[model samples]
Target chain A: MSAFTRFTPLIQSLPSTIPFVGPEAIERQRGRAIAARIGANESGFGPAESVVQAMREAATGTWKYADPENHDLKQALATRLGVSAANIAIGEGIDGLLGQIVRLVIEPGMPVVTSFGAYPTFNYHVVGHGGRLVTVPYVGDREDLDGLLAAVKKENAPLVYFANPDNPMGSWWPAERIVEFAKALPETTLFILDEAYCETAPAEALPAIDAFIDMPNVVRTRTFSKAYGLAGSRVGYVVTTPGTAQAFDKIRNHFGMNRIGVAAAVAALADRDYLATVTARIAHSRERIAEIAQSNGLSPLVSATNFVAIDCGRDAVYARAIVDTLMSDHGIFIRMPGVAPLNRCIRVSTGPQAEMDLLEAALPNVLAKLAGGQ
Target chain B: MSAFTRFTPLIQSLPSTIPFVGPEAIERQRGRAIAARIGANESGFGPAESVVQAMREAATGTWKYADPENHDLKQALATRLGVSAANIAIGEGIDGLLGQIVRLVIEPGMPVVTSFGAYPTFNYHVVGHGGRLVTVPYVGDREDLDGLLAAVKKENAPLVYFANPDNPMGSWWPAERIVEFAKALPETTLFILDEAYCETAPAEALPAIDAFIDMPNVVRTRTFSKAYGLAGSRVGYVVTTPGTAQAFDKIRNHFGMNRIGVAAAVAALADRDYLATVTARIAHSRERIAEIAQSNGLSPLVSATNFVAIDCGRDAVYARAIVDTLMSDHGIFIRMPGVAPLNRCIRVSTGPQAEMDLLEAALPNVLAKLAGGQ
Candidate 1:
């Protein structure tokens, strides 16, 4: 148990904890394989066939380091988004970019604001940089934009995070409200407008790419993980002002990108037809999930994301029992939000029909077992 | 030219710069294609067939995130190295791991010790974390171990970096000397014994894996990017005490690993015969490069790495001219060290026969042109 004793005080004060325990860890810990792999919001539909082919082709060149400037991918993204390549910055994923953003802005003891039960990974980064957390509560299972702005102004926080088509709860605010919130924030406050679930959301739920393209204080993060269905590829980017995007070059691991992953993302972007088809399939799957939840007498919240949150009409204890029992007894894996009120709901990601079929059959029996005190 | 107004003072003070200009950027800037890529120490020999096949196979699972715990890869590495899984931590690459290591121990103004002309990426990380650098000059081309020890003791520095079979100069000390240096350091000073080229080094040049396994202050970093010929795979690991290894889990992006890249590393490790073949090829290429340099009236240093550093019999100006003319006139891409003494040499990475043939044909012509004052 001997450790190097000279770690920075901030790093020493932090716990060695994962923001979310991945499903693989659960399988290992429980000695059971996940039958319905819908806990994480990864698209079970997978990436386009062309993307797989592109990755396979790129594999032959695996000995070459990826372009440190990320030229090709940035060019592709810019062409598609109606922006210049200088306005885009790529990273390992949105998670990695979030860490970089925190480092770029937060000094020790600086205040960062986010929803109480928002993405834990963001909170993890904020704390890693010795930033003080100033959390607002989720209002109506959606991130409270006005509350977040109020907290930011009160603390004079340098950073604020708000995810559209949010995770865990799968709720979202319309584009107009989000744009209003962005414009209302103080110019000094940097806003991370995460659009990780935008591809699966209603058109009205996402602002236009040009909505804040000139706004230096706003950075919108997008990912290839959800609708593009390449979660394992680890490609994500930030859409911000050119100068803001360039700031990342100061500290990012210049050659850290995986070559095949970049190729996968580029291929995924090129296949617009595939994206349209997959988003439709995702929508269909979400409907199926909602139907199953309703049939089991659970109230499924309206979600714009790739998942649905079903209210169990009980406390966190009951929700915890359902999550654990489903995983342990039936090999089903689903997750719930981490805090009060939100934890009253269990989140299930949309997946292919086979996984949906498994969830359909297991939920009623799990409810019965719980009702009968197991 | 707009950016967020309230970035940290440290971030504001730092310039946006990349440590190394990638060949791709050079190609873009020069408006030419590189006919021979022997720069950046990337293995143009490429990865093994088995590794490529594994990556192609893993491409289908690109929709699922890599296991955050990295269980399979960790198990494979531990089994190969005869250490427990807890004694290792994986990252995007050695570059990424160096950044994490810097963040772990360094606060603003903390002194960090390294060679004067060592890896620029390591220096970038230290500077990015606001650590004050204390550099010891190289002795004869090899890193000066005693001088580094002196600096660490003089500054009471918490961190020191020394790479074996060093980059740019490609020089190394005997394993016994390295171990002696490690033992001589104050226990309070963390030693980063970077064994990036160990696979290609002579048996006497590398200490046994268990040499510093019990030492809490020593962390040895190894990469598949070198001998395994998988630079684009972005898989590197740290061999350290279990406690120190666990510290990475505190700040690392848990799910940052690319699925196909990890698959390639696992496959690369499993195929020991291919590793042997590639390392042999690398060694052969190095000899061919040395011959080319000698025939061109240059002094090629004995190299343990995949690259040879050839003394141009002049100053940095001559080395810089040779590098620039090789690329601009012959489309041959190579690099030189960044500082004095080391900058008298131009570094060439070992590659396949084709690239060596290009270098063989071009170096004399470029030298002739330089002699003619072109």
Candidate 2:
């Protein structure tokens, strides 16, 4: 139980708690293999064959460290997004970038703002840097933008986070409203506009790529993890003003990138047809998930992302029971929101038909078992 | 030029600088492709075929996020090292882990100790955290372990870094001396024993795997990047007491690991025969490099690493000329130590015979051109 006695006071004060328990941990704990891995919202549709080919080819070159500047990847991303490579900063994932962003803006006791029950990992980074979080409750199962702005102003917080096509709730605000929210924020407040789910989100749900290009206060994060189906590859980037992008260089591990992962990401960006096909498949799968929820007398929330959050028409306990029973009884893995109101819904990721089939067959029995108090 | 104006004073004050200019950047700057990629200390001998196959297999599963706990990889490393899974923490690489370690121990203005010519990435992390560096100079081309201990004691530095079978110099201290050094450090001073080159070192050069397991203040860093030829995979781990090991979870990006990279590491570990073969090849390549240096009228230091540091028998200017001419005139990319004394030597990574041949054929001419002052 011994530990180094001289860790910083902020580090000492923090708990060694993880933001989320992964599906793999759940498998180990339950002593059962998951039949449907829909919980984490990863695309079971998978990446393009071309991307797989690229990753396989890149494997032979694994002896060399990846380019520290990530020049090629940046050029590819910049070209695709219609932004300059100078405006982009790449990291292991959006999660990693979030940690860096938090470190850049926050010092001990600094106030930060985010929606209650939004991304817990963001909260983890905030607290890790000794930043005090001022959370605004989600309204209508969507992140409360106005509330977040109000809290930021009242607390004079330096940082705020908002995820579009948000997790757990499968809800979103329109692009115009989001743009309005960014414009309304004080220039001193750094806004983290997380667009991890933008690939699958409706076109109207996302702002033009350049909408915040001139706003130094805005940092939009995008990732290859969702519709691109490279979650395990762990490639993500930030789009910000050139100066803000350069700030990351001051703190980032220059050679931290995985070569094969970067190759997969580059290849993923090139295969536009695959992206279109995957998004269509993801949309279809979402429909299937919604149908399964409705057949079991549940209401599925409207979704722009690659997942459906079904309202169980009950409390957190009921939703938790369903989530647990679905995994325990049928080896179907799905998640639920961590906080109330949203916790009444069990979130299901869009996957191929096989996972939807497992969900379709398991939900009724799970609900019936819960109703019968067993 | 716009940036978020509210960055913490420490971050704002720091200039954006990278620790090393990657060879890829050199290619871009010079507008030429490198023929010999023996810089950055990466293995051009490449990872085992088994590892490549494993990475290819894992590529399809890129749709799923890597396990946040990294349970399987930890179990594999623990079983191989005869340690418990709780005793290890995995990171993107030693560089990423160094950043985390610095964050854990250093606050603004705190002193941090390391050899002056040691890993620049470690120094980069300290500076990024606003830690004041208290550097001990290398004595006789080896890290000044005694000097490091004295500095740490004098400054009451909470963190100290020492790389055995060191980078940039390719020098090492034997097992007993390293153990003695560890035992002499104050309990409050966290010692980072970087063994990034251990796989290529002689057996007597490494302390027993369990030698410092009970010492909470000691965290031994290791990587798959060296002899395993998986530098681009970005997998590294720290072996330490369970309490200290768990501390990484408090601030790390939980899903930060690349799934394919982890698979490659596990496969690399399982293929013990390949590791032995690659290490032998690395040793042979190092010998070949030494012979080449000797033939070119330069003195190569005795090495226990995948690279050899060759003394150019002059100042840093001459050494710089040799490195630059090799790259510019002959497409031979190599590097040198960043600081004086060590900077008198040019560092060359061990690679395939083709690269060695390229170096052998090019070195004399590059030296001749430098001697001619053109």
Candidate 3:
């Protein structure tokens, strides 16, 4: 059957896709369960006991729509960030918030700037909204903040996206450089500073929350998905000037939040000791992944996030084969970048010791097989 | 601080608004704890014990993102609906789906049609997307099927909304007329056949699942929120042709579904006995609400939903006073319609006996005060 013949030209032009194939989809396609899931940058250490308890407690009350105002969660976030509740806007995840931000800023054919190999979900949203993308390549595996600002000016772009402790490459720019980039951008250009992995990054790598508190042009997005290990709960929030934050209220699906997720996130925020313990484990896992890579004669990139991007010492084709071989032959799930040069590396998320052991054992075998075949 | 200088003109034109204030907001504003929660059409009876069990079970696995394909939930929903999984598109809720649907078909200035006060959230979405709402007023408190079709033809509108077992007034039309309305619409005029209250409505009031299955232009939206009692779970779906259903995947937040919510919805669908039990309770509560309205000399509209619209024999001011007085004097929460004539009635959701008893006790006293006042 044909689709309704009248979908706006832009929607009709788009395709159903995701930035990365989920592990569940891989398991289904390969007809095998994933023995080790170290992909998608999800923290496999799991949420704090308090968060699980909160989710379990909130489960029975799943008949009431979450408050449209998201009063409690926003207040909790605001208190933690030392900002007022009006300065935060909560969303399903950074992915959902990206879509809303695109809708707010980009009309058809409007230019948006971002690194060519940055978060694909942000690009998906911009294209879904018919925004024209102006791509800038990464510099030294990190987002080119200078190039991004220059492109924003050249195109008179209204929006730019920069992820700190970035995805795929697992690289970061220092907080001072980030703040400088934000200050250098034209006032009319709104910058989405995605800090999804902020908790796992080093102290100096993150700006103080107050650094851009007065700039309506900046929205720093964060999520409980990484350090808090609540990816499936879909809780993410943004901090911006109160005026810009309120703009989300004008068009957001006001009652869209899942109640238990909100409860989980609130509980996760309160469990500081759990967060500290998990980050230490993540740091250990990152070291283990790098060790595995170096032992296999691969170059592991220095990472500030919860993942290690190891250069496979070959082209995209070789990296692709190793990724497929790991999952198909070993039941291990990992990912790679979509763009060339970056695609020469494979990205593995930090996880529990058992999964690390599985990855540690699987990597050498997959590498040996690939080298023999080549 | 002001918002950034250049949100798309359309976004800048819109105001931050909520369709209806939530009961939580009411509690916060009035500094009164709600003793009886019957507002906003939530099932105060709550979700099934089985669904709650499922959500609790799913809570620990909150570290992994939900399957973007939503494979299990879609398969289960498809089996129950006797439709292919391809024919269904899952979303956060009907409210979220409405936002997606609007974005799919609407560009700035495009005309969409629905009753003036049918569902404020739907109107909010249309206006949010820059779609011009061509509203047709309700005829005799029920959506005028003929009028909606006429508006679609006159405006050449690409989208129209009609809710069976409608909100606010709790009115409905028979299946035959609804089917006829669907078949008579211009094929290009996509109709949103909102069946939110289908389970609570009389059997004859709803068209069969297959009634408009072949028509690509008719998309039926149903929610676990209304009948299955998973409102906070945020699970809703659309039944349409596979092609149109797939259109949602192109623009939706692919990994946005909360894992526990999906599990809860799937469990809710399987608990048939619980659904039957709750529907009966809803019917009983509806009658009790009518009794309370009649005993107080108010006229209760014939309801096909889990709510009753009681005409208090006055203008919006008197209805508003009753709503306010109920909250302030007795902490009984309820709502009224937004538009004139319909605003003369207050709406109450069906719930457990304790809440019904509270409403039963409070209404007469509130009414007496209103009548005695100037």
Candidate 4:
């Protein structure tokens, strides 16, 4: 492979590695269709009907570039969040925003702090920008806020990432504890409090909008991909003080947002009734997933997210076999953590009953095969 | 406005300046609706009915993140372009891809070459990455290809940008000359051949795909946003040698593509008839805009793009006055170049007759007002 010979050393040193293999890729490689698409933590409930209609209507204007300022969307979000539009900066998604954030704060050899097995995409961005990562392990399946703070102080790190209603394990801490963590961090450390799963988590699990709104060092990343059911829309925003949010403008691709995706996000925001109904559906589905895990002789962890992580009471290999068999044998798609300890469990996203029914029917058989193999 | 104190020196020094103000921001700031949105060179013809339908269908799965590998879209694009799937990399749009390309090749203080008064967004990305811009001025209202090649060698620059069927001035070099320019560059200099307008350009103006396929230094960017009438879809791809194309995997947001946008692009590619019809429409609209300009005693440049650049026979002040009056008085939105020489002319995008009718009616009045003010 003869690549361009003049790429920067940092870029040259980087590996062509993706944070996660999407289920669609798996289907392609395996030559089988995914019957239950529950990996990647996307909402299978889909967007509101109004959002779909808005997207369909917006499709006609697909010839025009979306507004570089994202004026209307920012105004709508600001009005809803009770802050000035200047306090919000939108991007393609949280993944894109994380890249921009890493670029802004990290120089070569700079240290970044995160949980040992938090969102891999954030870590990918940090490494892409030549930032060294200092990871603290999860304590009791929840991100260790104290450990993260300790790492930040010890390394004098300029950046740290924490996801509330955490991914993979579906764990969360109370709002006050989260607020305390934010307040306790040194002002030099920029905290990315990712609230991607906020819509599905209990209200008490979320800090109030004003709790850290005055702090320029704290940014809360939110998305429309979960309970709002627009993951494919790729719309996400960062909420912070005006000065902090404006930093995104220094490096972001101003004209990057897709026209229909912005329209879908705006419409999704307007349809609170539909969101409430979908939230109920997601809760019910989570319980059903837990029930499915219990019936398979697995222990499902308590979840504050849109998914359940079931402890298989075995090693990582056994969990991996279950995940592979469920997909290969039954066309039921699921994912698991990449690292040890966490890899002892399998993760499944909440979806419509049809998908849950497929998972329910497939899990027991896959577990039986795994047990027999053991 | 206190910001995080620990931002890198480069980031701290950079200003939060946007390359262009969106029409929506103008509408909000002035408290008036845009009657004719012909400023940004967006296709007012809109996308095909089939593409719209595809987006509508894809919206039902909006809860799932798009394929991280973009496997299906890549296959579709490759099949359409008569290339292997590995020869392409998809992104949010050409603007986003430009950012990635700049990041890959430019380190701090590295010399990056482009034509003066070329694409501002491309320049914006180069500057954001801390690359020193070495500009070659346009000659006779067209990019000076010889000058650009000279500057690349003089500076020993690693990256250079050239847009065929150029923006702002709407001029293009013949395919043979463009291929010659690419071949003449030092092998170490990566060339970005922006063919965003290739779909509408005269066939003789575009090089064959395999012309520079072996160079490993040339990458051509194309977008569905032009003749396909899917600018808002934000679908763009780079065609290059497999090695050069694969470099994008090192840092691109692998799952950044919007699902419906990808569906729309795939559908747009399949509907060749719609693309042909829209191309004719754009060509006709260009002729209409030229006629409108000539009627107003202005000189419209010959264009192979979706927009026309009209010489108003005055300095930048007069051109600026006409543009401001067009918007403030009649809600007709148009734009002009950012630098001198080229800034003496105003740019207008091709649109439906209704928008052209607005432009036709408003231009003479705005020109008269400028004369009256003088």
Task: Please give the DockQ score of every candidate, comma-separated.
Answer: 0.90, 0.92, 0.85, 0.86
lDDT of 4 by residue, B54-117 (tens): 9888878788898888888899988888888989999988999999999999998999999999
Give the TM-score of each candidate.
0.99, 0.99, 0.99, 0.99
Stretches off by above 4 angstroms in model 1 are none
Model 4 chain A: worst 10 consecutive residues (lDDT sum): A56-65
Candidate 4, residues A2-45: lDDT per residue as tens digits? 88888899999999999998898899889999999987788888
Positional deviation of A334 in candidate 1, in angstroms?
A: 1.3
Query: How good is model 3 by TM-score?
Result: 0.99
> Which digits, one per residue and each the tens of the lDDT, describe model 2 over residues A1-374?
88888888888899999888899999999999999999998999999999999998898989889999999999999999999999999998999999999999998899999998889899899999999989899998899988998999999999999899888788999999999999999999999999999999999999999999999999999999999999998899999999999999999988999999999999999999999999999999999988899988999999988899999998999999999999999999989889987899999999999989889999999999888995
Better of 2 and 4 by lDDT: 2
In lDDT terms, how accurate is model 3? 0.92
lDDT of candidate 3 over B43-92, digit per residue (tens): 98899998889899998899999999999999999999899999999999
Top model number, DockQ: 2
Writing each residue's lDDT as its tens digit, candidate 2 over B1-374 gives: 98889899999988899999999999999988999999889889899999999999998999999999999999999999999999999999999999999999999999999998899999999999999999999999999888998999999989999899988899999999999999999999999999999999999999999899999999999999989899999999999999999989888888999999999999999999999899999999999999999999999999999999999999999999899989999888999999999999999999999999999999999988877875
**How high is the lDDT of residue B254 in model 1?**
98
Residue B87 lDDT in candidate 4: 91
Q: How high a TM-score does candidate 1 get?
A: 0.99
Local lDDT at B219 for model 1:
99
